[model samples]
Target: MGKVAWVFPGQGSQVVGMGKAIAEADADARAVFDAADEALGFALSRLCFEGPEEELRLTVNTQPAILTTSAALLAVWKKAAPRPDFVAGHSLGEYSALVAAEALSFVDAVRIVRQRGAFMEEAVPAGRGGMAAVLGMEREALQAIVEAVSAEGDVVELANLNCPGQIVISGTREGVKKAAERAREAGARRVLELAVSGPFHSSLMKPAAERLAKVLVDVPLADARVPVVANVTARPVTQAAEIRRLLVEQVAAPVLWEDSVRTMLEAGVDTFVEIGPGTVLTGLIKKIDRRARCFNVHDPASLDKALAELA
Candidate 1:
């Protein structure tokens, strides 16, 4: 039988009322949300279930909210489904993957992600940096443009290599703008600016990464029970020390999402279960290989569908 992998979604996958239904029906899931509230000393559940949209979108709030919601969903699903053989997550979702692998405590992961979001926002001034998605372009072609733009005194660089023909670049506003124009000139299908607080996954986030390293030092991270495909290296890592170091580096490094998916595929992961708020990762996995079976569990309905299918 092909091995199974559990993946998690990152920031853009979050939505208002994401975990409300599952949490309301499942005590285990509810407890996860409650734990987050106590850890953060606020009603993170309320913000997630009843979002004002603006507040929930804030980086500090979004990170913890997504982590808490993903954990809550996992609490419900793990009760019925078999444990994943391998685990991975996209960008901020890496913390969720660690929690799934028992590498990071859910409580600690939530708190750390909250702090991480704050540091990222503080790293670059508002409107100073941005990210944009470039479609219908090869990585090499777009990378060359990014390098050329940065060489002209801007700092744009590849951020998320999501899949073939789809990549995201991050850097200063002017740099991103220049790169976007150049990408268009290079025959990119489309270039859309991302609605993000800062230029994440870029060298501009070095300060944020440094602060995160110090915070991680005080946090307890155990070795994983399951191999976790890291975003920075696109390889499975089980050592706590190595995972900790990669977590710090991931802040300013490109998310090798496509590479990570390919690694899992080569390792016989034919089934991918995305246990989080949205189906973003599921779509990306399908894009990587149409033969891959993908399932998403965000609420009670999705949970039922995935459970029945997996069984």
Candidate 2:
């Protein structure tokens, strides 16, 4: 009844067997998997369908795995649903959104993300950097805590503005610990350190962003067929050059997810179809605005149900 925006999930949403059902049920979906494997020169599909869990969870493997799976499911669902008025994704999920918007080829996207993951992994040495989620705290209050900590040389900063009362911070392990402590003392409901490989979405990732920019230089990017709400700016982007620049910057920039959602809502997107492995984005969207319709389509059953409801 209203405009539609198709959003995708990022890391931490990846699960083994993510694309198996869709690949088995749709020939087009299977091709997406095959193409990713060929591009990456390995059986990434096998890893996604049958994971050791440990290997799949690695940042390098998780990036491509989630991108391929989301692309495969999109292959199955795109024909049945209306073309989205806009597309957006969380952090790593931005590649999936670019693929969906036809701004980047699926093969190029998978390869780029794999390299992106590697760069991010190498940006910070193991155990030195970390991230944490803070709950029930206002952004300004959390910002002050992060600023005070960083001013003292710990270098923590807000990473994800996910939704009301939910924000993620990233930086050195000591910085994260200090920020978490400050947040808790400031009356935050909770602050949990995340088990991640590095401090993503922080200035600590600048080295990774630089490496990724070099990798993207030769990759062909096309103007988006549909407007893609960008993670760095929380605004619609269609130019290939602008998207390319944003992709590089997004690595070290906070994901303005809440603002991006609000932008879409203002653009008349009352329905959101999250086409990925988990309901993470859907839950966030509900927290952002409970009245907006949300649906998940990771498998044939969910795909059919969403299509029916949307129709």
Candidate 3:
């Protein structure tokens, strides 16, 4: 078998009842959810399993909820199959990857991400900032547009470099709108606004990053048992000090997801198993490297399928 890399999904991938099926079928998965509830001092699993859509979408709730679900699925995988050689995650999902790599405990990760989500939401006022995806544009072109627009308006920066032709920009609402228009004019095929409560992974989130830096000091981070590709640097971070620094910078830095995947591939990771609520990372990995094998374990059925394939 080829070297395996386990990936996790970030925000915007959460949905109601995401881990219910797995929880119902697997005692270990249910235990993971139960632990999250105890750690968060709330019914996060309830909200995840029985969301009103709006409530589950709240940043504070969504962040911990998704982390719980992903970690739960990862627990099932570890119990059932061979461990991955490497791990990576998008934005919020990076916490999940760290937990899986034994760099951080699952309970600590859940609590921190809950704070992370709350900090991000409170960083900028709701109506003041936004994010948009610019499709079919090269990174250099998008960077130029962001630079040109930032010169005229509030800070607009690249947030997520998801794949070859997809990049998400975040900033002040007006600045993002201007950047989107400029991107379209600069030959982008489409610029679609994203549905998010706050503008994340942009310079406008510096305040949040500053706050999260303090929180990082309290969380215990150990040397990663498995290499974890970082979001800001697109490189494997094993040292605890570097992990803390990159995680803080990641709040206001571009999520180098495409590059992260490429870096993992270069490091001998040919198969990717995404342990999360959705197949978002799996899809992006496939787009980044068609020859790379990818799989997602979201629920009971998917977990069974993945175990069978891996076994």
The per-prediction tally of clashing pairs is 0, 0, 0
lDDT of 2 by residue, 1-311 (tens): 78999999999998988989999999999999999999999999999999989999999999999999999999888887768999999999999999999999999999999999999999999999999999999999999999999999998999999999999999999999999998999999999889899999999999999999999999999999999999999999999999999999999999999999999999999999999999999999999999999999989999999998877
- Per-residue lDDT tens digits for candidate 1, residues 69-100, read 98999988888888888999999999999999
Error of 2 at 62 (Å): 0.3
TM for candidate 1 is 0.99
Most lDDT-accurate candidate: 2
User: CA lDDT, every prediction?
Assistant: 0.95, 0.96, 0.91
| Residue pairs that clash (backbone atoms under 3 angstroms), model 2 | none
Which segments of candidate 1 are over 4 A away from where they belong? Answer: none
Q: Summing lDDT over every window of 10 consecutive residues in candidate 2, give the lowest-scoring window.
A: 74-83
RMSD to native, candidate 3: 0.9
Q: Ten consecutive residues with minimal summed lDDT in candidate 1?
A: 76-85
Give lDDT tens digits, candidate 3, residues 1-311: 67999999999899999999989998999999999999888889899999989999999889999999999888888887777888899999999999999999999999899999999999999889999999999999899888998997668999999999989999999999999988888899999999898889998899999999999998899999989999998988899999999999999999999999999988888989988988888888889999998888999888889888878
